[model samples]
Target: MKRYKKYITPYLSAFVIGPLMMLTEVAGEVMLPKFMSMIINNGVADRNLAYIGKMGALMVLTVLFMAVGGILGAYFSAKASISFTSDMRNDLFQKVQQFSFENIDGYSTGSLVTRLTNDVQQVQNVLMMGLRMALRAPGMFLGALIMAFMMNRQLAVIILIVIPLLLAAIILILKTAFPRFGEMQRRLDRLNSGIQESLTNVRVVKSFVREAHEIEKFSRLNRDLKESSLRALRIVITTMPVMMFAMNVTTLAVVWYGGNIIIAGKMPVGDLTAFTTYIVQILMSLMMLSMVFLQSSRASASMKRINEIFDTEIGLNDDNAKNKDKKVTEGRVEFKNVSFGYSGENGRKDLVLEGISFMAEPGQTIGIIGSTGSGKTSLVQLIPRLYDVTGGEVLVDGVNVKEYSLKHLREGVGMVLQKNVLFSGTIEENLRWGNEDAPMEDVIRFSESAQADPFVKTFKNGYGTEMGQGGVNVSGGQKQRLCIARALLKRPKILILDDSTSAVDTATEAKIRESLYHDLKDTTKIIIAQRISSVQEADQILVLEDGKIIGHGTHEELLKTCETYSEIYTTQIGNQSIGAGEEAAV
Candidate 1:
């Protein structure tokens, strides 16, 4: 509700316009009854055609005014509703971006997308419909009742009896249907999640011959959504017929009671006719109110879902970090007693890294070799503050990473993930992602150094060739080289490659590495790889097992001193023996 109050000024203006439109509608309804009474009591009784013509024109003019008021009210109300929803969507998108990894992991991507798109749209529709009808229904109902009582108080009794029964039926329907609508929304989120997952992994699904299985799963979820929707509709469908039946019975009673009054000379024919019309008007208005209630019920459910995201406070805050006189520096990283676990409250039994310590000076390369799930990627992610250390601290350039502004920290580091992703754009456009203002010459230089220039030159448009979504148009090796080129464009102080060269051939990998070592002599490099040959030339190597560093030294030093490093090297490089002197020569 507080989130709703933020747009109060616009809503208040809409509320004010709604009543003015209602007043015009009431005036038009009021004039019809008076005109009918005049036709019977004055014009027809005295046979005065001129009086009937004059009253008929006045009624037509009143209707015209009502139409104009309705148009104006609709225009303003729609504008307010659309503007409010647009602002809310922007706010939600920005809020989602601000959330920490912990907060983001709590909600599925599909669920957040549904909340931003469909849920917000549902609420906006309710606001538009509620503004247009909420005011008019009550005004029409009460004004008609007042007019009916003034004409003949006895006939108005039928409306009093009928209105209460209608109200009870509406309340009963709402109580049953509102809960079902909320359940329907939850089911929709699940359906969206399934579709998103399947689409993202379409190739895997096809490779496994699971198309039929996926179709069946989607059908089951679709059926659940249909069932929930039908249940809510069933409840609402019961109310309309019951209300109409009650309205017809009330109409019959009014006619029967008014006939007796006419015969007893208690009411004129014209007044009885006007009285019946007002009774119909009141019942119709009540029906409109019931419809408004139904829409508001659905909107209420959607609002609760939207507010859940809005109410969540972002977990990461840099408010207390020093912001004064900060300067970006060449990357020199150190980790001291750093321990981390993915589980927040489940203790450190599932720790990814335990009591880890390491150091990498500027212009030197550190190789990280580990088995799967050994926290290699997790270790490098700490440098860029992707996730803050659960215990101890990671330092860059001798200062704690947490102490630096996120903007400066991220700008000084470049990373290429194991799973390479690319956006849809030309080759040049994608290369410019790392440094938006990189010169054409720098782009070509980095591409050639990464061994991506050959294939890029093969395209008719060369650097201007379009890549499909996620660079699906390119082969795996091409994507890897392009991602490396992107990172090189940043000219980062710290460059971390997490198995980025796996898809390329070893010869190309060696060439790229040789070029990188020569070009980036003043930059810090960290390489995570499965192949020992990929990292054997590094200044230092660290071998990890089960989230703990078990070996650290140069290749020759580790081969002589660390058993784990030797076993892995022998397993990958085979039993062919090479002297330590010969190994260093490569």
Candidate 2:
């Protein structure tokens, strides 16, 4: 709760102004009864019309003061609440961006979305209501009680008895409903997760004809959220009736006891009437305070949940060594006996890469071939320090990658992912993401090299053609080509193509590879592919099985020595084999 101090000043102003507003309300209420008493006992009883007119005008002036104070207090309090919540929303978003991948995995995408939107709204509502009611209700209640006691202590005694009963009712409601509201929020998160998951994979559900199954799963979560909310509402609903009943009983006691005293000549009729108004005022103020407590309990639950994300410490931090000296090499990559596994208490024991050792100098092409899930993508991800190795060190140039600033290490490596993703923009706009100040000549050259220029030119607007979300307007092969061209535009020292050519036909794939080798001879390349044709011309090839490297050599040497490479080569290219001319070039 104290973490929100930065946003508390405005709320504190609302608190201070609230008492002033309520002071005017009490003064107005008290003075109105006095005017009525004067009109009844002095003006009307003495047949004095002149005094009546003066008292009426004084009553109107007090009412005007109360109205002005009420409006000013409401305006400032609303302004403060809105400004506070806006700052909270911005801070929450910034904190979420700072979270590491591991920390983010603890929360589902939908749950985080709900916390940012719905949960924050709940806290905002409470802040506004607290300003309007919290201070005013207490001051009005106590002030009215003091006035009633001064008028006639006998009638005020009923208020003392009734106020405690209302307080007890409020406490009972909060104790039961507060915990239930927390559970309701958790259930809402689950419901949100179910909806998001179903929408993201709607294609899979339709293809498998499992729409009914998905609907049923979502319905179950929705029903649970509804039930939890209803249970909390039932507890809160008890508060209003119980509070009104206590107030009603106290009112009846005041009227009955005051009537007997007036008739017995123990009290005046004017004082008894004023006493009734004060008693009603006290009861109404208590009821408003009870309502504020009910809302505060629910908001307290939401605030705690939001604060949890704000308090999460970022796991990854820049090293002091990187700050002092942040130089990194172009394309010299090395993995020294590196082993890695996902970190958690119940995480898998089987390592993704076990004791893998490799080195590639500048201007060399390293080919990685493996079965699916053989850790090919995982290995290249370490060079840029996307995820640190669980054991051993990854080096660029001669320095440990962790010692270099992440910005310096990533700038030297350009990557094309296995799944092509494009932003919603024109072709020229998308290409500019790789190099902001890239010239048009450079864009055309890379596009031509990656075999994407021909198709791009065929479009009505060419470079200005608009791409839909995720490049949905383009074919898969075209998307892959554009991504490859984008990476090439960076003119990086090390280029990684992770099965990037899979969407294209064999002829196009071969032509692109030939052009890449000829044009990018000076750039170091790491190609991870399932096809033998993609990597046959490389300087060195690595064959991985499970998590270990089983072979490392040239295409001709590996075909003759390594069993896994020989088997893959036989299956892909067949027994026709490479001729003397082809073998020498490969």
Mind giving the per-residue lDDT tens digits that candidate 1 earns over 392-477? 88999888887787777888898999899999989999999889999999999999989999999999999999999889889999
| Off by more than 4 A, model 2 | 8-64, 268-274, 319-329, 346-350, 425-427, 439-445, 458-466, 518-522, 574-586
RMSD of 2: 4.5
Which segments of model 1 are wrong by more than 4 Å?
Answer: 8-15, 324-327, 344-349, 575-586
Tens-digit lDDT track of model 2 for 329-406: 468788899997666667544578988898988879999999999999888878777677889889877778887776
Write down the lDDT that model 2 would get.
0.83
lDDT of 1 at 168: 85
Which RMSD does model 1 reach against the true structure? 3.7
- Cα lDDT computed for each candidate against the true fold: 0.86, 0.83
Candidates in order, TM-scores: namely 0.92, 0.87
